[model samples]
Target: MESIKLHQFVPISGEQKPARVPRRKVNGPATAALLIKMATEILTASPTLRHQTNITLTDLAAAEKVRKALLKTPLQ
Candidate 1:
């Protein structure tokens, strides 16, 4: 079995605090399916996603492609 590594702690008072468990940067097969399934609900709850970008991902292959694209890009 494997565990996830954590980073990006926040400061509390004068000391740094542990950050919440972060989400997986890349969506796997199940994750992809779940995201697509929940996307309508998520969008209904928060329509801001419409302004960010419209993405349609129906499979794991598409999810992996998106993950790869996001992780490899650099910040401006």
Candidate 2:
């Protein structure tokens, strides 16, 4: 009969917390698509929140720039 051996957790020396693994990078178009989907969900869930915030035109313009950049559109 073969016996199974379970691995035990070993804490790293001199470190109180474990190191964080780096996140995998998402490609450009996929990232933009995800952002658009998230925005749609948020807006649909809480339409009134948009009217209550202190988001200025400049902020909006900056966000538009980011959105355009994410969508790979040429800046005007």
Candidate 3:
């Protein structure tokens, strides 16, 4: 008679992977103010003058006006 051998497998435990950290939003008050200025310019511009790539003088002036106003006011 021949003897039989059985093999067993076991899982190895190791150090856990480094935890993932969430990234912080870099866009702050300055970006918000710019966005507000751009939105105001677009909203105030005439429909026919609204262009995707190019900004007309009127639109630029309007946006600049809003941006200046925003800068004059204190951020809350």
**Candidate 2, residues 2-69: lDDT per residue as tens digits?**
99999999867785877799998657665775686566556545647656775444555566566666
lDDT string for model 3 (1-76, tens) is 9999888876655866657999975645567678977676665565555565465667667777767776676656
Q: What is the TM-score of each candidate against the true structure?
A: 0.25, 0.35, 0.34
Using TM-score as the measure, what is the rank order of every candidate, best first? Answer: 2, 3, 1
- Backbone N/Cα/C clashes per model: 0, 0, 0
**Which regions of candidate 2 fall more than 4 Å away from where they truly are?**
1-26, 53-76
* CA lDDT scores, all candidates in order: 0.56, 0.63, 0.67
Residue 58, candidate 1: how far off, in angstroms?
A: 6.5
What residue pairs clash in candidate 2, if any at all? Answer: none
Tell me how candidate 3 scores on lDDT.
0.67
Candidate 2 vs 3: which has more lDDT = 3
Best by lDDT: 3
| Alpha-carbon shift of residue 63 in model 3 (angstroms) | 0.3
**Position 29, candidate 3: lDDT:** 55
lDDT of 1 by residue, 1-76 (tens): 9999999885568566668898767635445445554665465455466456664334434655665565555543
Query: Worst lDDT window (10 residues) for model 3?
Result: 46-55
- Model 3, position 38, has a per-residue lDDT of 65
